[model samples]
Target chain A: MAGIGDRISGTFFLVLGLTMYLFVNPNYIESVNGGNISPNTFPNILSIIIAVCGTMLLFKPTTQQAPDLRSVAITSMYVLLLVVGLYAMSKFGFEYVAPVLAFVIMIAIGERRLHWLLLGIVGMPVLIWLLVTIVLGRALP
Target chain B: MVELDTILAGFADAFTLYNLSFVLFGVVLGQFVGAVPGIGPIMAMAIAIPFTFGLDTLPAIAFLVGVNKGGLVGGAVPAILMNTPGTPDAAATALDGYPLAKQGKPLKATKMALFSSITGDTVSDIVLITVSAPLAILALKMGPIEIVALMIFAFSVLAGLIGNSLIKGIIAAALGLLVACVGQDPEHFTPRLIFGHWDLFNGLPLPSVAIGMLAISEMLRRMSMAHGNKVSSAIINLDTGNPNDQRVTWSEYWSCRFTLIRGATIGTILGALPGIGSTAAAFMSYAMAKGTSKEPASFGKGNIQGIAASESANSAVVGANLIPLLTLGIPGSVGAALIISAFMIHGLQPGPLLFTNQGQLVYGLFGAMLMANFINLWVGQIGLRFWVKVVSAPESIIFSSAILLCIVGVSMATSGIFGVAIMLIFAAIGYVMSSFGYSLVIFIIAFFLGPRFEKSISQSLALTNGDLAQILKSPVAVALLILSVISFVWFMRKNNQVNKADA
Candidate 1:
């Protein structure tokens, strides 16, 4: 039997294909070659391909390496951290938020070494800040 | 006929101190990352694209090319010393390299790899310099119908040849095409999927999409692993006091000349075709070497020819990959895709017209590519020791710092936070796609080619009034379409047989 990922992706593709086909308004598809083809024509064809692929996977699924829950959790944590970090950087300046964010990310990735942690937290931000602000003359955040 | 004066003028342009310094810097940086496991050249280039925004077109490309070429040389370092390949392309190098290191001949293995790699790269670059112009000129004859058929053929070859499953690869490619359709319809410029957000009219930023998928996704994957990059394999001791063990005598180096030539030839051929990557080339060359050898069993047990075969072929792919990119605007590998994106970013389109219109720029790039090969050799010889030390850095700090750098890069390239948001979203999508066994490389290649493909299709439709029968009239187009069908079927059978064998 196929894994949960295969099933989920299969369903996702089926839904996506159906939505694209059903929702692409005719007004948006400019007709060309006396309406023999349009911009929507390719997407319509792609939608069919997408649907067939989904149906094929449903019936004849291939083996996929199942991702672990812990990995998912870790990825989620990083995403959450980035979202919050982006929010935080928007509120505060990048210089203020960057070091703290860098430090947290390092900890999240299992970096417990003191010097390495220090370098990542302090060295990374300073280097990036100097490069962006001073060298490249680009704004941050 | 190829002009000598233009070529020499290009050499003069590349000889400038500004360009050469960036190339040197790029090679050094490439070696640094390539020594470390997990952070390969593709990830580095994706992240570094934004840094080139402030530089000129020539220096910017020179830097990235140098990084790419340098990474190949540096990848062999950890493969020889630690038995862990620094890049996917170098995985086969560790087969013989690590064993030789265990025999207290790490230097000999590394040096031979360096020499053979330079030889292969040089050979491919010469081929690229000579043939790409004529090829591009030939490509000029292809009409919209032929271009449409050619791209379909490329996609077919790519879908079947890349990744584990053809179905999954197709799904990924289809998804990429869908995502690419988000901004506007290519023919009439009608909005298709932009959800009334005016900011999205320009489409998702390339740097954002690319870096997010390639770089952040990789870092996320590493962080998700059990031991992650922290699994420190035992590093083989490098300096044995014996001088004979450290040196590759002239006879030993000369012995692998034919093996080097064969590997280079294989790599060059494979690299010319879209999507047969250096990893495949390296393994293919290694297989060919072992298959043709008198002592096949000696392969995994520290064969010098094995190292020569793997390194030469993989490195040769770098130069040969540009053949299709420069000639036909089709990238042969992920690395070449990045290079094409870089070219596009610099306001230069890489097609047949690029050769005809921007002849000087094209020649200068060629000169720079040739220059990168020599610099890669020199830098590899000196920096091998430095990179060996860099290999020991813990992956935790590296990944953490790298994620921050990626945000910086994307924001700079796209001019603000909007692009960063796009990157974040794509990063999540990339993680899901990767976890689901979809090919990220295929998705990216498809995404990059989608606009061109749609345009060509639109043109073909206009030309033939959407008549399928008309496409059959063009012999070249019909031949390509048939080849695509044949290739797909052949690969399907091959994949099934392999799966059955495994089962």
Candidate 2:
């Protein structure tokens, strides 16, 4: 009865655990024969536990809610835009990218009102800039 | 003895106009965010934490405490009016609240919830102020082995109780532990999991992780919903202006006195314990109140006592949860965990030593908590109409603005866009984990405590010369280990029973 989400998550964890166990380094120079309780010990233990949990999840017959693909798609698109926006910020500075990101996100989320959109695009970035630069005295990225 | 004078001085500090304004502002903001359906207090607190960097420790902590307290009262509003609890802890309130609202007494139900919340919260704060000092004093005597054993017990309790599946909870905790180990090895001062990224030498910034998992992931989840603004349709009409239906008489309040007292006591006790969250406390109190009621069948049919039981218990949890955080350095709830991060950001380590090292600030925080209770009551009464309007505002705007705020806050705190990138990564992880039913609370808490766990175990190993037999020499550590084993077995048995029943 395990749903697609559980199966997918199980496979993910299993792969991740195995990869970390096989590849990650956990030793330091000060340890005795890589130390009985070296840094790797905890991570190794955790990896084993996760791998076991993943195996159990794969085999366990339990009900799970199905993932919403449509919502996932929309959220992915939003995240993609966000990443792009961050890149743009790096290129053109926060002041330029902030309002544009806000405007695009508001529209994407279905905000149709012009005034609200304007407020978000124009007002939010300026307010945040003032708060960061003047009040907190922190440099904007 | 000195604690008394520190407390008085704290009261004086908290009463200043500058500090009081922050408390008021925090409560107001908490109520607004709590009244909103998709956003909750934890997210609000996360977004607000970066703002506290500029303020002194007292005002900053006071502001955050006010937000946490205000959220307790504000959550009840949506439960009473719309039958949609704003926070998970307030879900039990809707059982009786919606029915009461339907009987044309929405105002009455909201007022009852508010009064009971304030009363419960104040009493819990009193318990916290009184109990935390003694507990911290006791904790000061604990060795590394005892601390290690105690953390194991906490992990077991959290993994066992917080989420539906114990296996998933443990898996989440394991993931958290792995993530926590990404920084330098505490003992050797060498990098453990930092993959050639100098920025990660300090490990994953806490503010980024917190904002990502709690706030950004939540926004992503809400965005993914088909009916994006469905909560807007659940708004109730509270403008009836009927004086008779609006006010709760003294006799009515007195009638539910026993229920409120019992609920508060239950919440206080449960909140002080690790892993038993406010939601459980509220439901447990509601069940007990119903079982003891003269008319049990009226429980879900507009019974005021039902509202009293749920509200009092949940609100009581807000203050009582701080007990373990301040005393043992273990966060008893997600809110407490976030507060712990704030403490770290402020350069104040929370635990037994906090009382001795920073007694003035600790007592100041206590005074602030007391003041927050009064602020919650006063602000909640005057701002009800304003909050109703706020809740109805477009979700797109709120969430979009939230995105902007997250970027601003993270960028400001880390002074770089790198934190934003880290936040997005964790947000994706959090979204996936939550969608699959893993407990984010357990994950975040484990992450927070992971370093401490490693330090304690390493210290204990050094002390014991890697001999397990030496750990048994400490009676306190032995007792704690036994208790941890018992808790693990009990929770496993309980989980199996639940699975069997489900099957």
Candidate 3:
């Protein structure tokens, strides 16, 4: 799994570095005191270094234990839920959406206890709001 | 000479009721988080940074320092009790600590660990207080060329000393530099890679990137682990009723004094150097103690010196790691990096000017560190039982709430939803890099140092008119560049040897 991951990352970085070198604008109206190094010099140098390193990584692969697929799937679902909840909060308001998001994430992660679920669903957002608005005197999103 | 007036004033400031209370609070929270497996000090510090927004600068910094110091002592508890180290830095402690616990002397092992930790931390803090000012003064003499050379040396040391692959470390660092170029060009004030987004004009928010990569990504990774639900059922049976088993004799402690001193020294030196982390310091000290022991074979079989060595070294790193951060504006550890960001948030730039410009605050921070060591020792004794229970809390609750906090914290800091989205994006990127065995430490440090590096490079180029020969004219810069080359070669050689041994 690590080997495959490295291969993909290597290729991605390699392509990204080459594209940046080829396409990114290196032109500046004026350089720093007319020195040879431009704003693009640093990034261009870094891109070259990255491309070379990526190439080396691709050539000499290392072995590592594979990650669990079930865990990955669960983690992906949690991320998806987070994105959806954030979107919902943007459309609606945090007061309405935060509790439901917390409750849904708890359930998604296998929390089934009644009191814990209740606390997560209702109590968590209230506590956070109080801490933000009351204690810190900062308005919540 | 040290400024006695400033030192006294700093003590006066740090001993205030509010500061002390926050210090106590930080220690308690740090102990709880550190004693829980999968929640290390770095994560705790990163998560705590946003909360510090509400605090005064001195108290906020003191609070975070208290957390870091408390974590060093707290991590030893589970290592002694269940043979499961709460943090990686305490893994060496388990070799002798668990054995001692199994001998029905858990209290003795824990007490010894606590004593050694406090002793080492105090010594290292004293060293930091004394050494940092002089280092900063020396740094003030450096020109842009010297500063650039110094940064290069730091990068070489970091990439060489950390992680399995130097190439991967470099790649991570390069990626970080690229990411740091997202907003505006430092010199030209033109958009470099904004891609038409005005948010990118100010660059990615530091808090968002830091919290996402260091805290959120790790939380997600832990949530995905197969054994994420398997909380340890084993408990420490502290034979508190038995005096002989519960207490470390004065004689016994005196006998291990040399070992404690050696471990603390090793930890201080290594911790001050960028990229040599506490885990390495602890194991190195442990090995040194074992190698020098008269009964070497008995070293790992419940030897008190083993616990002393490991605990002292790891704890010492908490203070010593600040040496680079306070003096050079280079963070020597993940915790130090987070602290740097906090320093920035408080509008105090780290580096040489900090000592000259903010001498009172610097001394106050030193005083706060010394206070935190004592607080850590006192709190660890009273809160041991409470922390043990905290370790058993359900992962679902802790991580789920933490995720919410991450989101809310970013939103509150940025006053918009965009920062949270940036956090989520970086968290995904961090997770991918970590899974592929890239060094996130290198990446984050490089990113943090990126703008400074670019500025220094440009300044040096302008000063020297891009003349390669002019580099050799500055003795300090030449010496630093030479050291960088030597470190790079040594690191590659060491890595090659390790690879061959593994093969």
Task: Tell me, per candidate, how large a share of the native contacts it keeps.
Answer: 0.51, 0.46, 0.49
Of the candidates numbered 1 and 3, which has the greater lDDT value?
1
Question: Residue B478: error of model 1 in Å?
Answer: 0.8
Give me the runs in candidate 3 sitting further than 4 Å from their true place.
A1-5, A24-36, A64-70, B1-3, B226-236, B239-241
Model 3 lDDT per residue over B211-259, tens place: 8899888887887772335333455566557889987899999999999
Q: Which TM-score value belongs to model 1?
A: 0.96
TM-scores for every candidate against the unseen true structure: 0.96, 0.96, 0.95
- Write one digit per residue (lDDT tens) for candidate 3, span A35-116: 4466677888988888888887776644433455676676676677778988998888788888888877676656777777
What local distance difference test score does each model get?
0.85, 0.85, 0.83
CAPRI tier of model 1? medium
- Give a tens-digit lDDT track for model 1, residues B1-503: 34677767877888888889999998888888988888988999999998998888888998999889888988888888888899988989999999998998988888888888888899899999889989998899999999988988988888888876787788888888877877778877766777776677877679999999999988877877723344443455778999988777899989888899999998999999998989999999999999999999999999999999999999999999999999999887889989999998989988898877777778888888888888888888887777878888888778877888898888889887778888988899999889988889889988888888888887888888878799988999999999989988988787677656654
Residues B75-122 of candidate 2: C-alpha lDDT, one tens digit per residue: 877777877788988899999988988988988888888889988898
DockQ of each: 0.54, 0.50, 0.48
Query: Which residue pairs collide in model 2, if any?
Result: none
